[model samples]
Target: MIKDLFLSGKTAIVTGGGGGIGRAIALGLSHAGANVLVNDLGVSVSGDSEARNPADTVVEEIEAQGGRASANHGSVAEAKATEKMVEQALDTFGSIDIVINNAGIIRMGEFPQMSRSDWEAVLRVNLQGSFYLSRAAAPHFRAQAGGAYLHLTSASGLIGSTSQANYAASKLGIVGLSRAIALDLGQHGVRSNCLAPSSTSRMTELTDNARKHLMSPEKYEALKRMRAASAPERIVPLIAYLVSDRARGINGQVFGARGNEIYLYGQHRPVRMMHAAEGWTPAQADERLPAGLGAFATPLEVITDVFTWPPA
Candidate 1:
């Protein structure tokens, strides 16, 4: 049997807690003794609001399990709504000790074909939404002298994916935002970390080909072999740890969590720097370009080399 981390008096607000990995984490946190605020817009994958019962359903599940929880329906993309959601948590629970910024949306289209509106729409929800929530919660965390901030990122942020420039950009933006917040909030006792989770959620459900690529045939077979396996629940333990007192010293780090597999993401590797010294002219550059490019030659090589191609 697992020992309880003992969070009987703590309160948590999990944005996007209505379903998928967010719901799993909220359930785990509530099971550990925290009263939770479940905030979700019930938005579709494309950022359109659809279901109204998802957040309510999560709350009901928590209550049925004898865990305290309240539901809030608001788009994290809007600053006013985000603030109101945080306020609702404080009003209902009296204090906010943990926040999981899991609210996000995806707009996928190939570059040169993707509309500016689509790009902005993805950023509005995935990146700006997290910022708005964090901004609202920072003061509360500071006053309490401690809190946990968990942002949901993706493997696409750490690597490249085809036709997902906007999605990748937004996700990568969260990593930088989390790092900055960690640096600024550490002195105030606030811990900020990000999770790049590989779950078979609605987000993944939309892209079947992408799902196949993410899970190798062997890995998929192994997953099928396990009884009662759900990728959503598998990521919860790491989240629980990050929010627990045991992870007090861990901040500004990115973790990759999948079914029964947790790994640290984003360790800076050595880079080969090239410089055009000795007054190298354009002609010289072109002449020696093949050898200069070395193993990094070709457009496909460029695409495969960097996590975000043609960096913005």
Candidate 2:
């Protein structure tokens, strides 16, 4: 029997809630008893502005399902705008207990040819936005003596990738930021963690520019095939579990959601150690370090490596 995860009397702000993973998680949180503030800028996959608002659609869906929800179209890229969104949630819902930083955009280009604007656009939404929202909510959380932050990270960040330098940098930065937030807020009953999710969504469809930079043709084909089995909804259970009261003990951790598999990722740790009584010469260190550390070195994994296999 599937037992309902209880989150009654809670209020949440889910950024990028108009569609895809954000939409699914917003609905799930509502079903679990949280009053939701669905925030979406309704931008294109590339972060360009759009006319129709997606957040409204999500709010309507929640209401149709007999759940409470509200909509916000504030862009998380602006710090003040994100702060107002948090305040709006508090004003509308009467309290804010959770913040899911899922608003992000993709501009996949190989590092050498990637433009400055492309890099800044990705970082603005993916990393700075999360930081701004979390910063906005920190004081409120501290006052309440409890809150949760759920950041959408990626395996691309964890292992690195070939064509998406901007995306990888922003995602990896989120993990680092969340870890630091967890450390600083733990005493105040605030919890922060990141979700490295692999699933098919609008994001899975790369732009023409990104496709031009494809490193492995066969891997790209496999990714296209795998999307048939991937569902945005498959990622919601973990989001629900993490934000629930039951998961109060979980903090500053990275968890992976790939199909039915749930993975606990280890933080960066020393794999091999070397010490010299006195600082060794550069030549001497180069000679000995490879033998010790190189033995444990892992080959760099491409972005498609994580998503090429179909979900079972």
Candidate 3:
């Protein structure tokens, strides 16, 4: 049996804690003894409007289970509001020890058809919100001598997806941001990591393909036959470990997490150098296509097949 990884006196602030994977993580943290501050604007999956009660409901659930918790309904997109949200945790729980930056939204459209508003909205919440919260929490963590950040990214961030350019860009940006923070905060005893999670959530429900796969018995059974499958709870163990003292030495890492499988994401491949003449013209560039493209192509047999898990 696994031992209890209790936080006891620790305090945590979980953004987007009202629902989906965020709520799951928050509840898990509370179960482990942390006094949690659940921050959720409680917006719809498209982030169209607010639902403040969602945040309240999560807080009620936590308290009902004998866990100490408070609810905050605020937009992480607002820097001042985000800072204030973090302050609520400090004020209520005394100090902030963990931050789970799990709030995000998705607005899908083909690249040419996607509206500017959709693109900006997605970036504002998914990328800038994480930045605002991290900036607000860094100082407190520094003063306290330690803390942890777990950003909820997506497998789509690691691999490309159709009609999700904005979402993919934002999620990838998170990985980059976390890496930079991990480097800067390591000396201050703060750690930052990203989790590319595959879990059933309201966000995933927006996609017809995902919903069909999740709700249809045949598809669900097919998923079970796959080598790797993951539930939201499977991600909790990693998040719990990262926030604990056990992960002090593990920094600047990204994880691919799903039901029962956790894989480490390593260094990215850099663009390779190619030989070219000093005076290579546009025509020459076109002529060298076969050679230039050779290095980037996948095997012919696999080109038509879809990959369940693409390379990170």
**Highest-scoring model, TM-score:** 2
- Residue-wise C-alpha lDDT for candidate 1, range 134-161, written one tens digit per residue: 9999999999889999999976767766
In order, the Cα lDDT scores of the candidates are: 0.81, 0.87, 0.81
- Which ranges of candidate 3 are over 4 A from the true structure? 1-3, 50-52, 208-229, 275-293, 296-312
lDDT of 3 by residue, 1-312 (tens): 243655778898899998888898888888888899999887887897864558889899999988899999889999998999888998898889998999998998879999999999999999999999999999988988899999988766676555778998999999999999999998999999998876777776565353343344754444444313455767887898888887889888898776667788765774555666587777877888668876775433211022344222
Model 2: how far is 298 from its true place, Å?
Answer: 3.2
Ranking by TM-score: 2, 3, 1
Provide the global lDDT of candidate 3 against the true structure: 0.81
- On residues 154-248, what C-alpha lDDT tens digit does candidate 2 reach at each position? 88889867678899999999999999999999999999999988777788766422563454667656666656555778888888889887899
- Point out where model 2 deviates above 4 Å: 1-5, 207-218, 306-310
Model 1 TM-score relative to the real fold: 0.84
Candidate 1 vs candidate 2: which has greater TM-score? 2
Q: Model 1: which residue pairs collide?
A: none
Check candidate 2 and list the clashing pairs.
Answer: none
Give the distance in Å from residue 293's predicted Cα in candidate 1 to where it truly belongs: 7.1
Candidate 1 deviant stretches above 4 angstroms: 1-3, 209-230, 267-270, 274-312
